[model samples]
Target: MVDRFVEGAEAHAMMDRLARKYLGSERFEWLMPGEERIAVIVRPTKVRHIVGVERFRPGGPVPAS
Candidate 1:
């Protein structure tokens, strides 16, 4: 999908409209470690891929990999 966008085979404007309609804000949560001192609402689906990749471990204990 990223490749498609980078190659201009995908229309980012159309994608953004669709995302807005379906997700109604693309809202999500993030929690900081220790004491609940900080939190955030993340709205970018693309960034989630990076975050997931960071948390993912190949051939490790987590099932996500």
Candidate 2:
């Protein structure tokens, strides 16, 4: 839930899978969790609006009325 840390075999396996996908290697011992660095994940909880606008204009000059 909150302040959670990923540990153990399953989580490490996931990390290795993600590592293979991203770092092009499965044996990245350097990527292991340590005192200075730890695996952290953040997800979007809420989405309010996805807005867009469209305006069209002619390429050529506008004709006078």
Candidate 3:
């Protein structure tokens, strides 16, 4: 699994790259709420899946597991 923490334009660029490389002609589905900063989770399987996205709120406490 690969994870990336990105914000602003970098986040947009990363998503664009993933869409071009992995999603191809298919539409990408966002399974989580959009935020200014986020953690992208990439999982490997038969097909690579962008399985999870974690939103980060500034000044907010980290969520407990």
Candidate 4:
């Protein structure tokens, strides 16, 4: 499953949930939370980037300027 978050706190929470559901509670391989936008990188299975609200804008450029 892909994890997308609007805030850092949410992303962190999603990461924990996903790891527990998929990789198990003791697994450390999925420790790295992607970013404001994260993707599930299951090589042989699937590789996709899950974009979040942070990556969207309302009719304007949303750069961190």
Which one is best on TM-score?
A: 2
Per-residue alpha-carbon lDDT of candidate 1 for residues 1-65, written as tens digits (9 for 90 to 100): 22222212233344444455555555222323532222222455454344434553665444232
Model 3 agreement with the true structure over 11-32: per-residue lDDT tens digits: 7666767665566633335635
Poorly placed runs, candidate 1 (over 4 Å): 1-10, 26-65
lDDT string for model 2 (1-65, tens) is 24456666656677777667666787546653552434555556775664673334665333445
Tens-digit per-residue lDDT, 1-65, candidate 4: 43432455655566677666665674335344553634343334475678774644676553343
For model 2 the local lDDT of residue 63 reads 42
What ranking of all candidate models by TM-score puts the best one first? 2, 3, 4, 1
RMSD of each: 15.4, 14.5, 16.0, 15.2
Off by over 4 Å in 3: 1-4, 25-37, 40-65
Per-candidate TM-scores read: 0.24, 0.42, 0.34, 0.33
- Which of 1 and 4 is ahead in TM-score? 4
lDDT of each: 0.38, 0.58, 0.59, 0.53
What TM-score does model 3 achieve against the real structure? 0.34
TM-score of model number 1 = 0.24
